[model samples]
Target: MSTVADNTTVTEAPVADLTNVLARGPRPKRPSAWSASVTFGWRAVLKIKHVPEQLFDVTAFPIIMVLLFTYLFGGALAGSPREYIQFLLPGIMVTSVVMITMYTGVGVNTDIEKGVFDRFRTLPVWRPAALVGAIFGDMLRYAIASLVILGIGLALGFRPAGGVLGVAAGIALLILFSFAFSWIWTMFGLLLRSEKSVMGVSMLVIFPLTFLSNVYVQPSTMPDVLEAFVQANPVTRLVTAVRTLMDGGWNTGEVLWVVVASAVLVAVFGTLTMRLYNRR
Candidate 1:
């Protein structure tokens, strides 16, 4: 059909033409949960590609922490920089890697601010994929941080008594713990209204946990009250497991505690983050 008005013309397709257009091909299939997650994870990685400076924390920060602490506490605590690095390497690794986990939340809040997630939520793909995939992309940063710290430690003559197996196991455990730990920040990303707020709270919590724990020195040397809190700190538990592994020992108690706690962090915070996500 055709019509003309105001020096303009409009034509409508017939019913058979409309039907042929819609029936041109079968509809595309929806993506699977895992597939969708990986796609979002790749999106996160692409963000890094476009903005390479985002890697500063995973690279430069860990290097600075290692050099600063190794020199600052080396002579007084362990008689030499090399000596202190042995005790500090694994702890520093844990600190650097764990501290970076909060960026996952920051990234989430960034996406939300850009309305990127609004588009994601409207897709027919899995709901949790975006979050999980973002964390997955962050796992690469965690690994890079660990490797940078490890390389610095090695260059400074720090050697794990547990050798290859121990170092590998330690890094693996740290990655797993960090993966679970990222969920807390993800929840905050959803609950908080701003990226600065998420970063502010994350720093407040992380500073106390990292500085007050057994990351820098032995908890046994601290006052009893401080030592008790140090012993109970989750980062302390992680450092213990990591240090023990690097020292050529298997402390099942410490390792199991970390594994179980990691599970709990994910189970609890993962649920909460998803709820916030769905409701958002």
Candidate 2:
């Protein structure tokens, strides 16, 4: 009886130890945040590599817009093709930057839905910042797209009156605005479930915002009702501010407001997205 009891106790001890080990769970691994961010960036680059055609619009659309607008509406709009191209180029560039920001949300939603991000969560890292860094790194592609469009604009005889420094400054401001806009979309992507729905939701807000601004035409030419909206629109202010800077015009208020507004947006959306990411 004593020998049977000892054997049973020995068996029970190993079983209890095994149960405790299983209950304690696997040890969490520590991952470097910067390394994770770089990994996310590489993932983005790989995606871009596979879908090279994804960038067609950025590469081809500018030329098409310049051709169509310069040929079709130039006479009625600006009296000549050259004049129309000059006027339309800035608006097209700004609009393209704004439109490109939409991809940040779409990319995020796609990653989340496709289990790419789920895999990411299994790794120990500053997960939220890793996502943000990925989105920001992708913005570099958008910036390059903008630069390519601008280069084409120059080839089409669209000159900035503000010289090289002014052109650089304009590009800088546009890039900053794009980076800020990306955060809002990132938040949306993190909070949303479906990738396809992101565009619908974003456009529902962005289209009117871009159209109501001084994007395709001067605000003064718009009807009073429309003009009022354009005058007050943040996008309008940003475009005008960039134009003013390029044209060497005085508009300190516009510049100040754009910077302040962009900063506020980055802070608000970035914080909200981080919180939402943690919850996820």
Candidate 3:
């Protein structure tokens, strides 16, 4: 063995040049905005596939909320759970969907903390695709939560006088509002350093918006000053529009308000969110 080793010639193979072997052709075309966003949206959906526990919020939590409110406040509010479910369902759907929008911010913060966003920024794709696509994915979750509440309400004897068309419109408007509303949280995600802080601020803003408004009670029952605030609440307007739609009619004024407010939220918060995202 020693004799063979000593006799063997020390011939080293030459290192291959990866520069020539690698992608020597033209670079692939940059993805279009729609394509990039859809790709990112698929990524978000795939995240849910890997971690199905995320469905808990859209499914179980909404179910719990539907049950808790229908029974807990039904009798006191409307003489019976069945009767109150009619009034309570749409508003609660709004509450649950909007409340869950904060998780968008939490998710953004988590991704940023994990350096996922850092990698995203280095990619050659549409700038806002990640944020927009994340919102698109969240739109699905919002719809799921809305449907969960709606299904639970239906089972609880809640009937939509507006029927299928009305219910569809109601759900459509709610999802649209939730879509625009998510931008606010994305802004907070970029501004905040941690998920807890993002969630805290989101809750602080959401609770007062949802609770102080007409979600649980009519503004008529609130004092004048409180009622004024409730009337001014954008969530109140959205709920009113959704409720009216589900009740077989349209609330022109509230519907207009919701539309205008949605536009404003997307314009303002959307701008701020993009700015922060770029800087971050």
Model 3 agreement with the true structure over 21-93: per-residue lDDT tens digits: 6787798999999999998888889999999999999999999988998899999989999999899999999
Which residue ranges in model 2 land beyond 4 Å of their true spot? 1-35
lDDT of candidate model 3 versus the reference:
0.91
Model 2: per-residue lDDT, tens digit, 160-215? 88887777777778888888888888888987778768888898888888878887
- Predictions in order: lDDT: 0.94, 0.79, 0.91
For model 3, the superposed segments whose C-alpha errors exceed 4 Å read: 1-26
lDDT of 1 by residue, 1-280 (tens): 2335622422344655677778567788999999999999999899899999999999999999999999999999999998899999999999999999999999999999999999998999999999999999999999999999999899999988899999999999999999999999999998899999999999999999999999898898999999999988999999999999999999999999999999999999999999989988
Winner by lDDT: 1
TM-score of each: 0.93, 0.83, 0.92
Candidate 1 global lDDT:
0.94
Q: Could you tell me how far off, in angstroms, the CA of residue 186 lies in candidate 1 after the best superposition?
A: 0.8
